[model samples]
Target: MKYGVYLRPKPERAISGDAYTIREAEGSVLLGLADGLGSGEEAARASRLAVACIEEHASLPLVEILQRCHFALRNTRGVVLGLLRVDLQAGQVRYAGVGNIGIYALTREPFHPISYNGIVGYRLPRVHEFVAPYHPGDLFVLYSDGVNGAFHGNEALLRTEEDPQEIAGTIARLYGRPDDDVSVLVAR
Candidate 1:
């Protein structure tokens, strides 16, 4: 899978509390995003820790990875997390998420994965797993709640074979606000 990510802090802050990572793991690709409880260094630490833990345990099941993140983050301010694993060859996508992070399959008929209500580290119920079809040209997009909920990029952009970075940047530019940190990630 080809993917790109973009993140920015609130206008008044020098750093953002949101963190994300995309990497190949075993036979699938792993995409993880975390948004700390607030905007600041502590929040950044929480998000960084969540993403780091996810990266380290990329081989584990989605539930196990979420469990590890919860345990690892017990000492800090909690974060909302979304994790996705895509096996292109197998035409499958496995996902698990908590809180408001958004995950969508940007095909002709878009698919939005519903994240359960909970915070990753502090308060969470039994995490649920979701599955979706994985197609070569289809785009999968994820973002923090900071991004404007109403901002969906031009359909033509998705139709073209544009670079993932371009798509992410475009979304961030159009929907990102000055009042909060924002992050946009796109995978194709």
Candidate 2:
């Protein structure tokens, strides 16, 4: 599978409040994104911390990593978290998330994955894992709220054969908000 990402800080802030990490194991890949509660350096710090935790424990279960993130982030500003793991050998995806990060699976059909309502580290709700069928060419998009939430499964965007980076960039440029830090990650 291939993956790509694009990010931009809120125009008004010196640093973006969003952070992300990607990890690949022997037969699976893991991706995570964190969005701090507000914009600026402090928020960036919080999100970075969350990403660091995710990267450090990529070998663990998604829920375990998130649970660890909750504990790791208790002292700082809280953040919204999203986690995705693709089992290449099994041709499936396992997903778990909290807060407003937008996630969508674009295959021959479009479907929105469930994200529980809560904030990581502050008020996390019960975490539930979701499993979905994945194919070689399936497109999965995970984005922060700074990017427009409405473009869940835009066919024009998902159907293109462009590189993942180009796809991420186009969406970030076209749908990102200037008042908030934005990030878009594309994976197959």
Candidate 3:
């Protein structure tokens, strides 16, 4: 099954805060979301750096891929990471992230948030690998920073939406705050 992706970020002057991307191939798929530390270029920079590594190493070992990213950002301000890896043939998904980046898995439930352990920056330990089984119709939602005006960042839509990219575009156009970056990606 092919996955749909969506994204929404706050702010109009500059996209700072949220970063995300989706890559679907024959047997492999990758979804990434990053939240820069603050608003403006700083947040955008951090988010860009975080997702860049994930996109670059989609085929690498999950643990190593994250470690390399963590190390790459060691000299800069910390950022958050929300990533999803799907093996189409295997019917499995590996979900992970740090900081405020979030994940919502849509199974039978409506909104399910998959929590992560630590923050991505400076001297943090590598994240533990977490794997979950996936079905064809399952929905995955990824969000960055504080979505629009809501505190605690934005939320993900796993249960309700069928078109991830459309959902992402809609969210960006609808609730995006005048200040801050908002990006969303949905896949299933």
Candidate 3 wrong stretches, greater than 4 Å: 1-9, 108-113, 148-161, 169-179
**After superposition on all CA atoms, what RMSD does each candidate show versus the true structure?**
1.6, 1.3, 4.0
Please, what is the TM-score per model? 0.93, 0.95, 0.78
Residue 46 deviation, candidate 2, in Å? 0.8
Number of the top-ranking candidate, with lDDT as the measure: 2
Candidate 2: tens digits of C-alpha lDDT, residues 1-188 = 78889989989777889999999898999999899998898889899999999999899988898899999999888899999999989978888999998887886544457888998889889998888777788888899999986675577877888888888998898889888899999997
How many clashing residue pairs are found in candidate 3?
Answer: 20
The sequence of per-residue lDDT tens digits that candidate 3 reaches over residues 54-112 is: 77877776667667788878766777787778787897778766666666666533434
lDDT of 3 at 150: 43
Q: Considering every candidate listed, which one attains the maximal TM-score? A: 2
TM-score of 2: 0.95
Q: What is the C-alpha local distance difference test score of candidate 2?
A: 0.88
* Model 2 misplacement above 4 A: 108-111
Q: List the residue pairs that clash in candidate 1.
A: none
In model 1, which runs have C-alpha deviations exceeding 4 angstroms? 108-110
* lDDT tens digits by residue: candidate 1, 1-188: 78889999988888899999887956689999999999999999999999999989988999899999999999999999999888877978888999999877775444567778888889886987887777777788889998876655567765668899998888888878769999988998
